[model samples]
Target: MNPSPDLSIIIPTFRREAMLLDAVHSALAVPGLQVEVWVLDDSPEGSARSVIEGLGDPRVTYLLHQPPTGGHPAVLRNRGAQLARAPLLYFLDDDDRALPEALARACAQLSASAAGVLISAPQPFGDDAQRVEEERAYFEQAVAWLAQGPSALRVVARLLFGPALLVCSTCVIRRDAFLATGGFSTTMPVYEDIDFYMRAVRQAGYVAMAEPVVARRVGGPSLISACTRPQMLAAYAESQGQYRRQRGWWEFMALKLWQRLGR
Candidate 1:
């Protein structure tokens, strides 16, 4: 088996077959980059098999869960990381399309920087698209006016209280950093990305890119859509404060202090 590629793009899917094909096609089409795309199908029917096989691109590998993941996207995501060969991991959803240039840029940034995670600005689409763009822009611009301290630290703090940076589809993370910090949360069904990515940022800081890398399809058949606003908020509230209670919290702080005092 081919062991290591420039980037490992993991897409976890349930019912979105056609969109999954689009997502995989866009990923495989990334120019001047070698990517291993892992499509994990959590659908019991294994409906994605034929489409993935028909693509016949060695770069794309499909796996059907022997028993479905019971609606936990995090389980499929974490399993992909365990099996992926690349040193860098980019998690993309079945419905989102990747912008080649921005993705390549993200991989390059993560390769050069020591940061654990790198996230690109997202281009939101679908219903309330304009509203989504406005809200995200407000946070990105506000990072400078509302927060103080180091760049990554400010981002960490800003997002911890509320979301400024989102869409894990646009984020690239070093393999070591991902393993060290722990991947997405298995227990929490909704807002699992929030729990996981926030922990990822807090551990080793993050690289925030301005250009949009992912054409995110919001207000669609996604986790947020499946849950009510109150349910989402409740899940966030229950898990937000607890994700940080991990083994590396103090070690991360020590490293931060050493960096601060070094100069």
Candidate 2:
């Protein structure tokens, strides 16, 4: 049997070939880390099979499903988590790049803290490819928000409206803690990450916030905010309702509307 890897990097990709390649390279390049990188392809016929195969890393596991089911990133994530042999799981977006020392820091934190459930770093990315000065300011502001406190409600609020540092790409979660929250919800097309984080934080009393782990490439095809307001609002409502029944109507409502709107 293969010895369990120290970390499992789960990246759900659709058709982002070049970006996915970059993510794979980053995962491999992170030194001193023994990691298994699983690419859950949501593309028809596993469009990335050849690419992942070319990477030639024994630690890489490439999987393909039918079109629509493959398109569901959340389901892919949960499936990856279920298959992970490691005690720690890191969910990465295909377009993001992991910092070289991220895994090292995460391992250290996990080793030190027995109580922390989720350990996350800041995500520094520009809204667009140009990488403007304003984006830097925004990035700094986002990191500051994540550094503030550890309230599940506050984390949910930031995930929905603020800089979105709570994205799975920058997070390293304890496997059991993630499984306890039932992983990601595949019911919604969007806001699944936020929904997962909210549930995980609510259940796991503490979530660790460390330095930024991934230099995320924002404004991708799958970004929730890239969608129009109506689509976004609809997802918000769906996610809110789901959170309500499981968590509470009041907290769900607060996260869905009131608190997000700064009411």
Candidate 3:
């Protein structure tokens, strides 16, 4: 059989067809490389299926799960990873767009650091369409920190309780490492990415932050980040509890403070 494409961009989309289309266009525009795009539709009515099919791109694969399994981003993500034709997987939001060299650069980074199981980058974008200067500066710092091996203490201190840990869409992970980590934690109502990242870092021996690979388009109407707060917090607390049980109570308490402080 012929080889699979080099990368699989998995997008878990609800109902944002227009933004999803824009996202697909950006993925298709990622310069040079054969890649597959999977759209995991969780919408009730199969709304985005036609739009995805109309793209007519053989590289695109759309999967719809109706009356969908709720709180299964991890399950959907694992399904995407399983269907992917490549050893490397990139998780993209339905509303995000890749920058010009995002995929190519991520592939290069993975190749260079065969030791790294997960490679993440900055998602540079603004409330407006244009890139903001502050975002650019922050990205530079993140890249530098990742290059230096952000450290176990740092990973625990910063990642265990920081805004930095929750952004899963910016991450590109190795297929083996993802599977080994048991994929995403489906049981957690929130902080699944945090749980996954901690496990991935522990298993992979290394997680590198490459230069910004994606230009994530934020400030949209249907952002997952814009989810209602009480629900989000409740989910966050549940995930935090899980992390505590898995790790330790003291570590969990420290992490909880970080969350409560809005860190």
Q: How many residue pairs clash in each candidate?
A: 0, 2, 0
TM-score for each model = 0.85, 0.83, 0.79
Q: Which one is best on lDDT?
A: 1
Instruction: Residues 1-263, candidate 2: write the lDDT tens digits.
Output: 13767888889888888989998888877677678889999877677899999978898989985554835688889989999998878888888888858666776677567643554654556557565445445656655765676465676665555545556676677888898888888877677777677667677655565577787765545556556788667876776677668877676667667445753
- Which candidate should be chosen as best, given TM-score against the real structure? 1
Please give the RMSD to the true structure for each candidate, in Å: 4.7, 3.2, 4.0
Cα misplacement distance, residue 19 of candidate 1 (Å): 0.8
User: lDDT by residue for model 1 over 1-263, one digit each (tens)?
Assistant: 24558888899998888999999988887776778999999999999999999988899899998688788889989999998888889888898899988889878877888888886666767678676777567546644443333455545544555444565676888888889887888877687776677678778777767777888776666677788888877777656446445535664454445445532
Give the residue spans of candidate 2 off by over 4 A.
119-135, 153-165, 223-226, 250-263
Q: Once superposed on the true structure, which residue ranges of model 3 sit more than 4 Å away at CA?
A: 1-3, 70-72, 126-141, 163-166, 222-237, 247-263
Clashing pairs in 2: 42-70, 122-212
Ranking by TM-score: 1, 2, 3
The CA lDDT of each predicted structure is: 0.76, 0.72, 0.70
**Which pairs clash in model 1?**
none
* lDDT (Cα, tens digit) per residue for candidate 3, span 8-48: 78888888899899888877776666788889998778889
Ranking by lDDT: 1, 2, 3
